[model samples]
Target: MKEIQQFFIRNFIAVPVSFGSWLYLLFGIGMNIFPATGLFIVLYLGSSFSIKQIQLSSNLKQLGMTRSEYKHIKNQLTSARFKVKQLNSFYGKVRSVQAFRQLHEINTISRKILGIVKTNPKKFYYVEKFFYAHLDSAVELTSKYSMLVNQPLKDKDLKITLQNTRETLVDVNKQLEQDLRNVLSSDLEKLQMEIDFVGVTMNRDKPVLEMKGDKYNDRK
Candidate 1:
């Protein structure tokens, strides 16, 4: 029932509401049928502007804010990639250890926890391209993390925890990368299936909407 309601709202209610408003604005105001387009303008603004919708139901089951986290992680990765590309372009060099560390930091936090939590294999594959595109940088980053983890230190427990975290992160990245590569074909196929579903539904209902619009205009 909820899904059907949502579908109706998205296609039937929302689109028609938007179209009616724009039509009133373009026609009713231009034709001097009303004192002003103020009412239509208000409704247009209200409906067109998006409110931040947190799907609390899905989040409760998923354990994380999926879209927000995905956007943040993607931004981080893109920024890192840009910086590395800039360095290589300027100096004709590969990468610095510190630069690699920054890359590693972004990847470790992005994949080890957030990416896995999202559980979207297609997204994982897309992100893997980001890593693979900078394979040299990634290898260097892994080496630097390895060195950091192996460094002898006085605080044994703290060192152990940090090493364990680093190793775990590394293992997770490798495993996920392989999984992404292996499933790329199937995941992409699934994406197409979803796209086809949306396309068919949209095509099926478009004429019904046109008919409704004609009726609404005739009534006016």
Candidate 2:
């Protein structure tokens, strides 16, 4: 589904606009009224404009993203998702329960981070470094591990390789969790500060009444 959407965004306008231009050129040729060079120039310019418009519209449709924001973070977003997709592609090939579990965890964390980025693209800057540093390694290691475990022979070295990959994946999972925390750190701090301020204000604004009961008893 995602691949289809990406293909559409890339070609939806370019193909149709280019084809329409060709049709116009053919019609003009049939009528003997259009200059070939002029028609070619128009087609080139129109196709370029159509491509730009489609890209702009696709970027705008991204939640919490402006054109500038999308441009700034597009690579990071694309890279992260590409890594996730790479890991997902190995899902069916995962033979061991441990490998399957690790892949599932990786996919879940990757998707969670992707979801956060989608909703709060401004935080993409915070996460961009982490994704660049670790995402590729995680995907590669997971893929290698999946392939290793799926082999029919269980050699001593294969067992060691599997163990080492599993261990590395545990570290990768920790890094992913840390990345998520880093992305949310500012918001979490803001929420904590607000809660503290409200608590203090409520306590300070509470009225203290001690003499009212005594006054009623005295009047009686």
Candidate 3:
């Protein structure tokens, strides 16, 4: 229907009038009658206005809807991005201790990977060694930094780091699920569990929000 509308808009003058005007144009304008021309017009009009036209229009509307959905997703992405950055900054403030640094490095990498997952989830589905293959240095540095913060386990500092890590981990899981959906890889289930474990370790105190989204979208 849109195509037909567009065609009419583009070639408005080319659309023929009724049969009476055809006769007038034929005689008055000294035009030659072409049988094939009339046949083409009949075929084009019949097809353009048929049920198939409705289906095509519906499909185009769905495309528009999907584009809008993508925009909503972008908003979620922006929020996730800010959270990840906050986690990174928190990681950097930890004192320099080897064990704490190791833990920090892991946590940082996890957070960064979560960001990437949020931005381009298809990467998670395609890459075999996803975490290792796409390891960012910033992630590594942050992980090490986080670990360093945990060394002496000062009650106040440990409590704060735990809160930060928990928040970061929640964002990570949300991003991963968004980006890595419907993957055929066998490791997907295990990956989800591992992410959950990380979250549980970081926040033994807080309640985790169970996602209410559809497990499978009919149109995805």
Candidate 4:
């Protein structure tokens, strides 16, 4: 939602301002329409990009992160998101109900984790294992399992490998759940802190609030 808001804000700030310059160049100075349009495109793109970067820097500062840290986390998140999309390709490749269910669980958990971090990039530090390790494991092992499951005639070795892959996917699923738990635990901690703060505020201000009741409460 914040990202969507930023998109609109960037365009709103950059578009008409850039277009005004274009209007001046084409009409005020009577420059050729073609060159003026070209310059307008360039100016619009540059200003839009600059505004986005400024917003990003400001947000990163508020998050107490350096630009380098933000880029690192964002890169990992982009990679992980791409890999999650790849998981969809396996749905048609998988056969058994168990295999499909396992893949679905992993994909669902991964997306939820990624959604949380993408919304609050600072949480990446708390759940690095999902982006760094377990997600890769889930994608790679699922691919391998799909291939093995598709074999026309499986030898005893192939069957054992399939079992091992399934077991590994189970572990991956659990780790994804753990990563989610870690992220949610952070949210839970923040919520508890807020609740504690509200309790304190009520206790400390109750008398004053009662004394001043109906004074300024409804106006604001």
Instruction: Highest lDDT: give the candidate number.
Output: 4
Cα lDDT listed for each candidate: 0.51, 0.76, 0.51, 0.91
TM-score of each: 0.28, 0.64, 0.27, 0.85
User: What tens digits encode model 1's per-residue C-alpha lDDT throughout 1-220?
Assistant: 4445544454554456766866776776664435335655565456534311323335334644466665665565566555445333322222346434544554544344334424442254455544454444444444544455555663877667656645654654565455445435565788999999999999988875464436655656
lDDT of 1: 0.51
Better of 2 and 3 by lDDT: 2
Candidate 1 weakest lDDT stretch, 10 residues? 86-95
Candidate 4 Cα misplacement greater than 4 A, ranges: 194-220
Off by over 4 Å in 3: 1-65, 96-220
Give the TM-score (vs. native) of candidate 1: 0.28
Q: What TM-score does candidate 2 get on C-alpha atoms?
A: 0.64
List model 3 lDDT by residue over 31-69, tens digit each.
Answer: 667854574476446644554545545644755444445
lDDT of 4 by residue, 1-220 (tens): 9889999999998899889999999999999999999999999999999999999988988899999998898899899989998898999999899989989999998999889888888889889988888899899999999999999998999999999989988988999999999989978999999999999998988775455446655667
Q: How big is the RMSD of model 2?
A: 7.4
Q: lDDT (0-100) at residue 149 of candidate 3? A: 52
Q: Report the lDDT tens digits of candidate 2 across residue range 1-220.
A: 4436765654675666666666676675563435644665576667767766666676578655677767667667887788788988998988778778878877887788788876667787777756787678788888888788778999999999889888998898888878888888998999999999999999999986677546636656
Candidate 1 wrongly placed segments (more than 4 Å)? 1-35, 46-153, 187-220
* Number of the predicted model whose TM-score against the real structure is largest: 4
When sorted by TM-score, best at the front, the candidate numbers are 4, 2, 1, 3
Of models 1 and 2, which has the larger TM-score?
2
